[model samples]
Target: MNSLSRMLEVLNLFKPEQPVIDIEVICSQLGYTSASAYRYVKELSNAGLLVRLPRGYALGPRIIELDRHMTQFDPLLAASRDIVGDLIAQTHLELLISELYDSTVINILQRSGADEQALNFGRGRPMDLFRSATAKVILAYLLPRQLKRLFDNAAPGDLERIGLTWKDFSKAMLRIRKDGYCISEGELDPGKSGIAAPIFDEKGRILGSITLAGNSERFNAFNREFLSTLMIDAARKITSRIAG
Candidate 1:
């Protein structure tokens, strides 16, 4: 691998569970020579991307600062904050807020009303549509050109099985645009259900969405049409807040 790629490879050796790890483990995982790994690690540490923690090299606060800077001016988050909070209050369930970037779901913020111990994500988490209802709603709203670009960048035949070709996909999107909500069962995760509605500005531009989410049993008992109405109402309230 190239130098930059190899440095990134070493960075991945640290996870939440093993936030600090040794050079030996890093070399084994990245298949780099011990000296090369050490050199890269030392460089990264000096640059503040990695830190020499008690255990080994853990990510430093600089990365956190980078993450904060990335999210500080994200318009979608600025626009949709209130709507998500309202959804949490009314449904007493969790909300997963995400936006599309480069056709992949990039930014995520979690909202919860209940204990939330059952929720498995957090603010600033990145998500995938293949694993979320939030992804489906965002995808259902993109223009045809954007959708084509997304497909071209995705696995050659991966999205075809999900049936989002231009013809049918446009129609599906129009439905959400008209009714302002999407109800899908077990789309985000096994046994999870979601009710999401698009949040639109006064100019009728779609910002993102507000989703009411819960695990299988609680979600299954929810009335889709009822949840749809709630989400649509929540979106309207949130849009007004954003506009103000």
Candidate 2:
């Protein structure tokens, strides 16, 4: 990795489980010498990306500030805010707006009714690559080359979850694109089901997806066709808003 990449990698090391990291841990995990690790930490601290604590270094307040900016200014979130609220009022189900960041699908916004089950997927969390309706709908609109690259790197289990072979995977994605939406049940979370439709940019490039999720029993009991149509219409509205 280049120097800039190495420097940025330090930020990736912080996770929910390991929120604080010391210099020794950084050196051990990143294979950097004590001197280089300290230098990186110092620079990151100076930039307000890391805050030094008595125990270790924790993520700094800059991340929170950036999150606030994204909440207020992200075009996708801004476009979908009212639309998502409307969907929640209509369906009384959990709703998510997710975007593909490189190869990762991240849920950027969520809304849920009071009686809804606690969802494993939440705002700012990464969704499953193959199992989530949110991710699947977005993936269906990806370029063939991009799909192939992800397929080549996928684990055997992940491949099997979608299909047994490359052709099968390709067919599944094609079907979703043709249908303009995806439905998944008990894939990412047991007893949870979702329907998702893709949103697009002005150029018609896929930007993200909007999904509605609920308890599988309740989801199946509802008029799925009606729900699906609602989700598709909502997604199109968000896309148009983005373009406008």
Candidate 3:
């Protein structure tokens, strides 16, 4: 791979589950020679994208700087912060704002309900797009060709887990588009359910998804119509704010 591509590959190796990675691990994971792996890590560390730790390397302060900039200025998150809090207060459910980045669904921010501590959704963590209402709602808005490409690239087990074969998956995407929102049960987290709506830009391009999640029992107790309405409304408001 090219130097830039190799650097990005090194950065991508750090996951929420494994925040620190050394040259040895990178060499093993990427099947790179020791010298090549060290060169990639050294470049990233020099650029402030990765930091040297006693044990290995972690994401550097540059990431935090970028995150602070996004949290402060990202139209979607800034516009929807109060609205997400309002949704949590009104529905007594945890809320999250997620963005689709390079086909991965990333949790950007979260608002807690009464059981704040119990709501363990990790902020900035990448989630499988096929596994949650939050991500699926965004997927519902992708162009047909893009959707097909993603589906074609997916593993059979992932397709089956989402309960869709190729033919069925297309039809289900259509239904999600028609419904304007998605309801997922025990998909992302067992025993937890969520409802999500897509946020769009002025051009009707999908921006991301806003979701309200809670215990399945709590979701069942609340009015489904009300929850869906709230989720969609929040999404629209965020879209509008960004448009202006």
Report the C-alpha lDDT of model 2 over 1-244, residue by residue, as the tens digit. Answer: 9988998999989989899999899998989989989999999999889999999999998889999999999999999888888888887889999998888899999888544466788898886577788999998899999889888988888877677689999999999988889999888889898899999999999989999998887778779789889989999999999999
lDDT comparing candidate 2 with the true structure = 0.89
Q: What does candidate 1's lDDT look like per residue over 1-244, in tens digits?
A: 6888888777767667777878888877777889988999888988889888777888877898877875676556666666666667767888866555545664366766564454554555556554455666777677678766765666635464345565664666667567767777665456666777666666766556667777767776767787877877777777776677
lDDT (10s digit) by residue, model 3, range 47-87: 89999999999999988899899989988888987897788
Error of 3 at 81 (Å): 1.8
Estimate every model's Cα lDDT from 0 to 1.
0.68, 0.89, 0.84
Indicate whether candidate 1 or candidate 3 has the larger lDDT: 3
In candidate 2 the C-alpha lDDT for residue 30 amounts to 89
What's the best-to-worst order under lDDT? 2, 3, 1
What TM-score does each of the candidates earn?
Answer: 0.65, 0.95, 0.89
Badly placed stretches (over 4 Å) of model 3 are: 16-18, 33-36, 161-163
Of 1 and 3, which scores higher on TM-score? 3
lDDT value, residue 82 of candidate 2: 89
Cα deviation of 175, candidate 1, in Å:
3.1
The window of 10 residues in a row where model 3 has the poorest summed lDDT is: 113-122
